[model samples]
Target chain A: MKKKKSSIADKIFVACNTLFMIAFVVITLYPVLNTLAISFNDGIDAVRGGIYLVPRKFTLENYQTVLGKQNMMTGAYITLLRTIIGTVFALVSNALLAFIVSRKRFLFKSQLSLFWVITMYVNGGMIPVFLLYRNLHLTGTFWVYVVPGAVSAFNMLVLRTYMQGLPDSLEESAQLDGAGYWTVFSKIISPLCKPVYATVALFVAVYQWNSWFDAMLYNRMKSEYTTLQYELMKLLSSVMQQSGSAANAAAAGATASAVTPVSVRAAATIATMLPIICLYPFLQRYFVAGLTIGGVKE
Target chain B: MARNTKTNAPAVKITWKEVKRQKFLLFWAAVFVIYGVIFYYLPLGGWIMAFQNYKPKDGFLHSKFVGFDKFIFLFQDDTFLKVLRNTLGMGILNLVSTFIMAIVFAILLNEVRSKIGKKAVQTISYLPHFLSWIIVTGILHDALSTSGIVNEVLMKLNIIDKEVNFFAHPGFFWPIVAFANCWKETGWNAIIYLAAITSIDPCLYEAASIDGAGRWAKIRYITLPGIKPTIMILLLMNVGNVLNAGFEVQYLLGNGLIKSVSDTIDIYVLTWGISQNDYSLGTAAGIFKSVVSIILIVIANYMAKRAGEERLF
Candidate 1:
């Protein structure tokens, strides 16, 4: 009788869990869906009232305006190039460094680990980094974005930890076959570390794709090379400026309507986010696995 | 005995020769050393600017080094004081709320039995993390505006008489920012805690059940304690970055009306350094933040070590 009652309670628990999970999914996805709906909605209608869960008057005008601009196209291309180059460079360097550091027989293994950890906790902040870039004559170049953030300490540590967990017997066998360190690492270890490599690559790629702060800070007078996020920021700023100016004009007896400004900003946001969002499903499994592996140590 | 002696001598010499032979390791080490020296240690010298009347023209070598003058200025300036308070306040709020939510979420997730259900929930939750803050801020703008969903619902429920401009009000700004951060990060952060929880032996819960412990009791005793070390280590590491209340969200959300509460040392440095071209003062502020971060990390690590917990060192 007690067992039967507990089964009933367990069923109730499972039902509750399902309901809660559905609610969470809704809460998490609602904003993203709303933005997409607003981007498609007529700008004038979107700004006037609450339109949640669906688009009232569907229109592609806002998207047209966003994509029609020459600057947005160029900015998208720049961001794409940066993400590709930066991810590739970061992956190679981080993987190589991590492989070397993970070798148990390597002299100064602990020392090197300590060195990387110190970098994680301490750093010269923005100004000195800026000055360093300036002195190196990389201020206005594309290299500025790719080079400075090329090797993340967090990614390196995760990669190193993962590599350390790999079986030592495989490496020993490779060495017995007269393979050198480089050959053994490249052939034997690199193949085994695919999941982690993919994880770090995704991380670096996402970071590069989403980053606008550095572009804003370091790329002054280089507006031609603005990333997508930076372009979205500029779009939002201009929309605000236009609204403020329109209000001023209205006060001075001018009849100017800025109905679609918010819609256009929404469109820009959707455009900026679409690439990463599209990539998420492909990487979702690895991302979870990677987090589990990397996080287990901590 | 003679054969053993000869072999031992050659073996020792071969190991010594192998050490000399491995020049590639030394080469890479040197490269890393140079990278560290130039990037890490050299910039540390910039921290000296915090104590000086830093002028770009005077440079570090020629600058008049005043002792703790800028730090004193920081204390005296009402704006700086307010920002410091805001940083601490928001830091604590975010840390506590996010920590609790993540732990709860992880525990709940662990109870899930259906594989597809778990996968679906994890997939949905993790999706938000990939969205940039720019996109997140845009979402916030649309959802929290005067005529936004939040206000509309509140008004319909008679929670308020009028529409509330959430972004404009200083009192609501920090909470809104914190909530947005939690919304975006809580799912991703919970993955770690969940991993820690799942690694707990299933037998422990079984044993607890045999002892007549309820589900709640098991969670309280077993799950919570299992994840405590991970929690402590994360907390210790997070203390160093408490001041990094994030720049993008605040910069995007803040306006002149709420600037008093929203301006962090980072935004302050940006304004002074790049906008006004006062590089020295900007560098000084940045250096101050860095030093404080380092000190916090060291102190936290020391405390952890003393408490017999896992230390970063």
Candidate 2:
């Protein structure tokens, strides 16, 4: 009798759990899908509201307006350039530093490790870093996106941990073959560390792709260097500030009446999100592995 | 690390010959160390501006020194206090909401019987975590606009008489920030707990079931206890980060109407240090925040040590 009651309770529990999970998935996904729908909807029609999962008056004018702008094109170009260049620069530098510290025979290994570890806990905060950037003449340059962030202490430590796990025999054999540290690092360790390198590469790439603050802070005056995310931010903020009864007034002053700020903002947002959405499947695999590995330590 | 160095330093001799043997490695190491010093250590030198009436023209050397007056002024200022309160308020709200939601989601996710269903839900859930805060905030604005779906639902349910402009209210700011943080981070944060849960001994669950424990009983007795160490460690780590409520969300989502509840330490620093050109005061405020962060982290580490949980250090 007790077993029968317990089984019935378990069935009800499973039903409720399934319903909860379904709700969770819906809540997580509905916003993105709704945004997609709004982006395709006619701007003036959308202002009437009630557009949910599908467009009320479907149109491609929003995307056309967003993509036709010179700044938007430039922003996309810069974002792509930064993501590619920044990821490579950060990965190589971090791997090199990790290789140096991972060497067991190196006298400065512990000191080097300690040096990098301290950086993770303490920083000079924002103003000091901003001042330092100004002093270095890095405030207005493209290198501001690439160079200052080239070697993160956390990524370096993650790479070092992976390298430390590699057997000493690999390096010894390479050394026996007249290969120096660079050759061993470039030819041997780097190839062997491909899995971790992929993880770190994806991490850096996503960060570079998504970064807008650096552009806003350092290169705000340089319109040419603005990133896609920053451009979307500008559009979104303007729309949000004037979103109520004044939205149409602002829209009439802009380009065509077909593309309101809301619709254009949605279109730009979807455009900005395109790369991430395309890469998310691969990102999910590596990041899950990366988090489990990096999260285990400080 | 300090202990290891003290014991090993006396045993190793610094000789020119030993250094020369690893000249190539030493050369690269020296280059990186210099790079680290310039980029990392050099910034700390600018902290001295906190004590001076800093001027860009006079540089760090010739600035008129004011001791702790800037810091004193900060504490006495009403705006600074409000900013502090806002930062703490938003930070604690985000921490609690994200922390609890992640754990609860992980537990519920683990209970799903279908492997494919579990994987799909998790993959979809993590979609928001990868997007930039700008995109998240943009979506948030659209959803909470007076004519948006939230108001639509509330009206359909007859919860309110008419559409409510959610962001215009001062009281809703913290909760909105907390909800945004949960929406973006809960899924990503749950990954760790999910990993923890999977590692738990299946034997324990089997034993509990044989003892006539229901699903909730087993979860309470076995699963929750299994992941408690992770929960504690993550909580302590988050406690150390209670000041970092985040800047982009507040700065992007905020308007004049919500300024009192929205201004954070980062915004305060940006306004004074960068916009207002009061570098000394900004540096002083920045210094205060950093000092408090380090103190909180130390306290958290001490508590972890006392509690015999894993210490971050």
Point to the candidate with the largest lDDT: 2
**Model 1 misplaced regions, further than 4 Å:** A1-3, A7-19, A240-259, A296-298, B1-16
What lDDT does the true structure give each of the candidates?
Answer: 0.76, 0.86
How well is each residue in A23-105 modelled by candidate 2, as lDDT tens digits? 88887888899999999999888877778889999999999999899999999999999999999999999999989988777
Q: How close is candidate 2 to the true structure, as a TM-score?
A: 0.95
TM-score of chain B of each: 0.89, 0.94
DockQ of each: 0.43, 0.55
Q: How far is candidate 2 from the true structure (C-alpha RMSD, Å)?
A: 2.8
Worst 10-residue lDDT window for candidate 1 chain A reads: A249-258
Instruction: Enumerate clash totals for all models, in the order shown.
Output: 0, 0
